[model samples]
Target: MKYLKPWRSDGGGLLHLTILLSLAGLRLDLDLDLCLLLPPPTLLRDELLLGCDPTSPAYALSPYPAPGGWGRADQLHPKGREADPAAPPEGQLLREVRALGVPFIPRTRVDAWLVHRVAAGDADGAHGLLGAAAASSAGGVGAGVDGGSQAAPGGGGDPRASPSSPLAARQEEKAPAEQTARVPDADGRASEENEVLRERHEAVDHSSQHEENEQRVSAQEEKSLQQKNEDENKTADKPDWEAEKTTESRNERHLNGTDTSFSMEDLFQLLSSSQPENSVEGISLGDIPALPGSSNDGMNSSAHYNVNFSQAISHDVNLHEAMLLCPDNTFRRDPVVRTSQPQEPFLQLNSHTTNAEQSLPVANLTAFLPFVDNQMRNLTSEDFLHDLNINIFDEINLMSLATGDLDAMEVSQLFQEPDSDSGLSLNSSHNSTSITKSNTSHSICEEGATGYSSDPESLPHHNLEGAVGGNYPAPMGHRSDSGFCGDLAFQHVFHNHTYHLEPRALESNSESFSWPEKPEKMSRYLSDTERNLSRDERRAKALRIPFSVDEIVRMPVDSFNSMLSRHYLTDLQVSLIRDIRRRGKNKVAAQNCRRRKMDIILNLEEDVCNLQAKKETLKRERAQCNKAINIMKQKLHHLYHDVFSRLRDDEGRPVNPNQYALQYSHDGSVLIVPKELVTSGHKKENRKRKREGIEDGFH
Candidate 1:
């Protein structure tokens, strides 16, 4: 036997002892009933199967073959054998075993136990057993017997031979039996060895069964947790579903309850019924039932109900019918006048008639009197008709003047007064009363001439005076010394026809008597501004205002105030002047505002049209660009295929189109690269870009 070196006194010593026994040709099979003798199947299998002896053919092919060549005989003898220089020291090996957290038995103790068993007559055909056990112990818990034996040439162990593999148990049982058969062991010792092996196998089986049970329990727990989460999600969604259902129900109820259709007549009725007294008589909005799901707040609920009711009523009513149902006095209607026979051409002048009336030609006077009398009679009945008749008479008078039947000089002479000094003073109460009575009697003649009964006593004297004064200008050019009837006449005329008279007529009539021919037609020729100025002119004339409406409106505030101060004006006249100025300014402002609004509207419309055109142009351009892009894409696709099909590798063989692709660089260069390489490069670039974008965002 080879003497073991002091360095090989640990696990290496056992390995050295096993080799010595093998060289001595001993078949001592020690049936030691110690757990240490039956090494763990995992360790035994690793040493016997995975380990390569220097004598084995597998060792010669191994990448890490032993330094010196050794045959089967040499392996059994191993002259001048020493521990492998590559093996760890005893202290390092112990530390490694401790790091692995495995139970470690000292080799000296194991060897001493083996010697004790041999001395006790236990070494029966157990040489092979001892060698296998010693080899396993020397290898340590998971150490390889040889440097390159732990893994295949590929540098990894076989997965099928792993310790945890299901077939490992069967392999473990077979390995022990094979080792036992290698030596001629007694049947009793063999049975005891088999029993010990059986006990160890059962222990491994029990541990595996425990791990499977734990896995099953974990799977059940995960299933329960998932089911609980799903139930929670369902419960959370239930309220939302119920709320939606309620909303739908309310909508259905609202639709079913309300009426939407209406007619024109109903609209009319609704409008007529809107009067304060009648509003409550119709169906009250509050009487309508509230809709389902509506809040029960006080004012809000009532307001909502009223709004709904009003909308429903408006839809069911007509405008015309509503108007018809309105009170008769709500709107004015004209009375129907019956046409009577034409009156006789006759003079029925009263004794109170002025000399101006007496001098007129009978035929001409008769033609004028009846019409004037009719107009005066209708004044109280319908002012519109009275004004219409006046306009008509003015037209007739103009035609008469054109025909030379009525002269302007003749008309002016009528207001001259036959006896200037003898004529009654306008200030005389008796003369004024008489003049008013004569005018009333002249107008009343329509009834007398038409053979109708007259009532001079019942006729209102003031109405007759106002009728004469308002309708016609008093005789002008009356000596200024002859009372203030001109002012009175102007006041009345201004009150009635202020907006109608021409400016020339107003100025001329104010100073002297001058009847312009076709004066009524002059109004038609006036521009809109002139018409507006004329209206202010009339108002100024009525109030006896000294300044023109235009100057009042156009003048600066300081100028206007100075003008107001210069004039001796009553509060009424001053108020009237200010009103005229305000009205004139408002009118001009309104006109300018309307004009600006029209310009703005036109500008907006033009902009809208321009924008629409621009939109259409852009759309067309985009379409053309897209079409060009599509054409380019098609050409590029075709070109790519053509180029790829003709591409050749370094060996002059046609490159596979599917395996290679064309890539464009930022510098506008195109290159052919492997498809997989391009795909992986693109993935990396995308990830880098994404990471950079995220970082930029944080910054």
Candidate 2:
């Protein structure tokens, strides 16, 4: 398995999971399907039966021998000295199929997939499918036992079967003599026993060649079979009698001779020869055990299995052609012939096919999509509240941050346990008038490593928090990002205004205070509305203005005048009220002005970006058009020269391209004009340019 480290600052590793099983000592291979690469199936199709027994060439290319078995990825031995001298070069092959450098099985995915197939097991189908194919040969070997057995136990493609060194032959000749001596045959019958063994060995050697002929095949036969299938597909309605006769003659010769390109149909013929019995062979998935839902009843059973080509071709027009995907991802007219060890089924890629997706031209889907306009997006005070999405309830115990309406609270509690009865709270509201009149500014820098940070605010609490003492606990929850809106607070900053509700102002509500006009409920109203009052609210209250801030700010000019006439306020009170109303209106107007200014700037930026992208696209298109125009002009020049050279004017002389020009008439005819006319047109354009220049100078 391959691993790539995380490319993020937060350290972590991406993991791939794979299971390596030793179930029943079978090495399983999974067949990959083209459709599985797309979305629909969600997994590989189970019908593409897996190949078995690793190919000799497949292992010869591996970097190192796999430690466990054939399916595992090779790993280097921890120690240098641990090496197997007898291991063949074929033990270390690393083979994989790929398309345009993309491995069919991603290197990062689990090595093999088979977990979803079998029940009451580790559920890898690699071996189950392998066993099913072997079941065919096993049945053949069982029935053919009477005919005579010749296959060696180590299986086909074993290096030991090949003829090699004379020294190995000498050892083989002397091995029985040594064995007989070790066995202590006191009856002295070793010579007679050796002769009997020699005769039996000779018969066994001769028998294997004939047996191997039944399965072994040459590539030419596979090629002919594919061609025959293609020819049949092309001539479905009108059969090619000559080609059919040729294929039949070739097949008869192949069966009569030694060479064979193993076909499933042939294998079943040699196994269960009856036509009706072989009909069920492929439908049974190479004799693999039936799944619970699959019907085991012979005829009905095939309804659950895919049609097996090995047992049931039935002269279908293009059935063989449907077996393999072509380069264009469509099925070809003939299946690719694959080869394997006579004892073990294996797989190979068809040398013929090419991938369709790689070859086809594709268009960009999003090229024509329209751009979005985000210029008018707004940041409201409600927007600021929702930015945090904070639910500030009495029970929640959230810190009031100092960045805005909420405290980016540098400190939640200002004092530690000085006394059980004493405590301190951090609040930044400007409502208190006399506790500490030191006006402080809070930082709104809003830029840093976390995309947010603040410079210190000039607060009286900083001095007091030192006089008192406390440390902080770890912060809770995700940090909320709120970009400071400095525009709304500009009026207060510019005017150096502080809106404070003084305790002495509310003292008028106490019974001891004199209210010569009437004993009115003043403090009750103030208490209920105090928390939500605006800066204008505080100013109106300080001046003892008789209306709410909203009424003062929103009242029309005529209505405001009527309100003033109704109230018998002093000159100082009236002036203060007018100043308050003017400042409030101007403040709102300024904020709108600023918001609109920023919006216009943002819209201009977006416009510039879109126009720049369009400019680049147009530049490329213009270059392409210019190239096309030049090519067309060159062609037209050649055509014009050829036409002029072939033309004769009145005296049977050829016309010259440089001296004459052709112009089309309105009535579908061509006329020749002298080259001097082109020169006159050019002179006229020069005069027009000069005239335009003189006109611009006068302007």
lDDT of 1 at 369: 30
Top TM-score model: 1
Q: Which candidate leads in lDDT?
A: 1
The sequence of per-residue lDDT tens digits that candidate 1 reaches over residues 469-577 is: 2223212111121112212221211121111223332332222111122336334433344344454564454333557677889988898888777654433345556
| Model 2 root-mean-square deviation | 45.7
Question: Can you tell me which runs of candidate 1 are displaced by over 4 Å?
Answer: 1-534, 665-671, 691-699
Model 2, position 673: C-alpha lDDT score: 81
What TM-score does model 1 achieve against the real structure? 0.27
Worst 10 residues of 1 by lDDT: 337-346
Query: What is the C-alpha local distance difference test score of each model?
Result: 0.30, 0.26
- TM per candidate comes to 0.27, 0.21
